[model samples]
Target: INDTFGYQNYFGIIPIFDKENLLGTLVIELKSQQNDYNSRFPELLIEGKLKSDEDFRDYSFAFYKDNKLYSQSGKFTYPMVNTNEFEGVSNNVVFTSEDTNNVSYSHAIRKYDNSKLIVITKEKMPYVVRLATLSFFFLVFILFGIVIYILLWIAKNLADSNAGWFNINRYLMINANKILYKTRIQFSVVLSVVATLLIVGWTTFSYIKEEYLKQQKDSIREKIRKVQLSYEKQILNLGLRVDDTGELQFNQFADVNAAYLNLYDINGKLLLTSLRKMYDYGILEKRMGPVAFINLSKLQRSEFLNPSEKIGTFTYAAAYAPIRNAQNQTVAYIGLPYYANEADYEAKIGLFINTLINIYALVFVLIGVLAVFLANQITSPLTFIQENIKRTKLGQKNQPIVWHRQDEIGLLIKEYNKMIAALEVSATKLARSERESAWREMAKQVAHEIKNPLTPLK
Candidate 1:
């Protein structure tokens, strides 16, 4: 019916019945003037809902009718969906892409005819959005660090209190100050190194990505020139004009290269493309992009490099150039597209980060050991002096600290020794005064006794 009418159409049949008495059948026919049923099928299945849904913008849909991959909204969506994978599935299927990080969730509905209508949703996470997500995780890590610091602070306070746990925590919090100096040094060293590494790694990753894209653009321009020259040579040898060129030779060249090629006529109508799958899946339009057309045709430029060419949620660098005849007249335009593989780029970044973490781990261990050693060296002398001061007593010869070096600690020891010497002299004077007072008391007692006896005799 579609071939006869020159339009694609779908039909629905309903049996007419009156109170359980079957009658005739009712038929409904819908025709599509666009004549693109394959392209329109997925759109109709979605009911234009994805466009209005902000949350589903990063998602692309694919439909499988009767376990066959029928249509997809994006070229890269549902790459793992195949007839073989659905053979034994008695329920919904879940799959993920092998080439990328896209995951597909499948919902299968059994039809009346025993066939299945499978709706698959694939997440299309772009690299830019991934970076934003990484930033969020980085912020969470920082918050976690702050929480750890606060907990340590509270523990330090508890160590100083007269609580039952004080003895157990006291050894851990050896520093006398409010903040543990040793812990502060360790945290500072680690945090500083981590922050520095993060900043440098982020900047370097950006620079490397930019430079790699620049190189890809340059390579694309070169490929376009090389292919253009090869095409012109082939046409000249065959004595054919631009209108007479076929896609066979063009496709052969495209198969030999890494980048996809697009050929457009003088009026900007697409002639052929190396990537037919993109067009078949409705991922690309069959005409030159408007910006590239104007820049190449109207501006009369030999070449133009579009650094931010977009396809679905993917961005690539596209290079365009004009194909000219021997008479210097523009015959057609050529385009080459180069996609940036974020997975590979991120893998490289991960490897670099892992290496940095390993190295910093070693550095942290060394710093910790050095900090402990330095803290012990600083606190050992103060501990000794503290024990001596506790033992110091009046009326007894107190031991003086004998420090050899004339540093800060030596000065402290000198003052402490002087206090001990003065204490000993004061003790001697106190003992002699007590003895003299005792003698005076004895003399008074004797004189009183004698006076009392004489009074009694009288």
Candidate 2:
């Protein structure tokens, strides 16, 4: 028999002896350990003999006769044979002897297969498996978030680079055409060389920058991995617990050590956030939007609404990752901002762009100036030769061409002078022939007149 007091109680009794003897009884008590009369056993028997003795040979046995015994205690008692007399069942019940006077005993049975005894202390507790699963999902989500972020970053960078290159190419082409418009064959080689060099330099610069960015991204990914490892370790070290309502709660595993961390439900509802809020003009929410939440796959495939519209500005670079569940579905996103802020990046890039613009502007100015100078140098002497030929065509035969350099233009001027001199000599010969003809005419007339007079006399 067994009884409990105060909180709760339970009792049980087992007959140690067979039906014929009815000698021994085993009892168990629940909570109270007190040994008052209300908690004492009624009687004990051994081998058909009513044993009233209090002290048995063994401390657990209340009475013993011919290797049989009896014992009594609070609300429960048991009598059994000593191990020296009965070896089989004696070895099993020997350890149940109580030393304290009013101690209660709870019975426990061990199975033969050596399975563990699981004690469910807090019955009203939530399943820790759920919490573990949630944690794993959270980590997965973070990993996905990181991946998506990186992919989107790559896509955006590619787009920006493509756009910039396109614009630069168009500008180059326009400038090249403008330079070619002067039709100066001498400057064509220099312009072509300059264009080739600019293209090569830009290409080399882009390659180096891309390689450097790739290395930086790799380094950042490694750092993020280390940080995640440390964070997970810390979360594990801080134990998980269950609340009164069977809910698993973890007070420590909330935050993440990323530049940007956000939590969202499977339905894409905002659950928690750690992002800066900025407002300007009439826009109350500056940085908060669906676009800010980086879905890597979507971002990679998504076309920008208006890429020409600048989104603030950036330099260095940004990366992203998606938070996924154990099932490999993305739940949230994490972004790692560049070491340099947007403002700083913008300022630096702006300065670089401005410097490039100034350089390009200066180059264009220099090109224009050079084109003008070359056109002037090429056309000046030709214009001079043309005007001189026009004057000579208008019968200004005495006019002499003043040529400084002894080149083709000088040779042309010398030929023109020789042709003018030949024209003048032909004119003097014609004038002499006319004068001789007139004199002949006069002589003939005078002879005719004198002949007329002589003819009449003859």
Candidate 3:
């Protein structure tokens, strides 16, 4: 007896034999309507998941049994067929497809029990999302700046009017105006370092992104050449030639590096492809790309590359080259479509930028500290000179500043010492002149008293 399972039924075939001769056969069939109950659990699970995430409200899914659709979540328009291909360790494959109506779908497939499950959502390109994100941030920054400007303007007007409610703002503005020169120097240093870091970081990120994309293009072109060589060898071994008179049947080739290939005839009509579902489901065209055709067939170029190819906003890189026969004649054109994963690229850039930010942040803190130290070092001598000038006197002995270095500060101290010396000399001259005048007045008083007494004696 052989037992087999079907989508909606179970079947058992029993063979009755008499001494090695089959006499009769008995078959039993049972309805497997238990799917109705089993299906609800997953539906409930999916419903709960969708409810939890509003972004996934438009998402849909389906289940397949041996390439047959078993159930689906609402009316899903994405055309899908099991390619019977096993993927990686997880037995899951991701697909992007577009329908006749140009509606794109981004979906994932998980295989289980000779069946596969598909979960799908509307397609969105990573670059588009990132651009939108940047636009949003820019708008937010602009809005905040406008709001701050308006507030400052209002504060200024209110302060001018001496409004009571704007006292704090007025006080703050006044204090800000009185910022110390040393503090200003420190702030300027920090701001300059920050600006320099931002500029350098942006340039570095751009260079890294450019180099990364260039490497991807180079790798795709190289892989396409290798595939072309292997394909030509296969054609020669199979004694096949690509000609318009007779349709050539080429064997499918698998790549260990997880690359896909497409073969086109001399006229640029797609003959065989590894990803057939892309065409069968209307996700891609059945004909070779026009740019590739012009380069490989018309221009007779050795190789061609479209660094950025878009299908419903999803961008990817594609490489193409001509395949030649032993007679050195163009036979078929080979294509390698490389879907560069932006996730890995983004992750790498994010990590790198984050590390750079962290390092710069630390540097910024250190720079700020150093700026404060330098500001103090530059301002300390001036502060000492100012204090000495405030305590200077005209009639008292004044001390002179003694500085060793012949820098600007030393020059200033030398001039201050000269002024102090001149002031001291003027004080000594005035004192000596006053002393002589007092002695003269005393002698005159004594002579007047003696003359009065002598006059009375005479």
TM-score, every prediction: 0.53, 0.35, 0.59
Best model number under lDDT:
3
Q: Report residue 16 deviation for candidate 2 (angstroms).
A: 71
Ranking by lDDT: 3, 1, 2
lDDT of 1 by residue, 1-458 (tens): 53322236788999999989989899999876432323222222344644354344335555455556556553344544455543334454545333344543433332222344444444444564455456545655767999999789777767775654656567456744577555666566667766776787678768876776566567667877887787667656663333435666667667665456888888888887766666777887888888999999999888888877777666666778888777877888888865543433455666656555554454544555676676667778888898999999998889899899999999999999999999998899999999999999999999999777865567
Higher-ranked by TM-score: 2 or 3: 3
How far does residue 86 in candidate 1 sit from its true spot (Å)?
40
User: Regarding lDDT, does 1 or 2 come out ahead?
Assistant: 1
Q: Provide backbone clash counts, one per model.
A: 0, 17, 0
* Top model number, TM-score: 3
Ranking by TM-score: 3, 1, 2
Q: Of the candidates numbered 1 and 2, which has the greater TM-score value? A: 1
Instruction: Indicate the worst ten consecutive residues by lDDT in candidate 1.
Output: 35-44
Determine which window of 10 residues in candidate 2 has minimal summed lDDT. Answer: 116-125
How close to the true structure is residue 306 of candidate 2, measured as C-alpha lDDT? Answer: 12
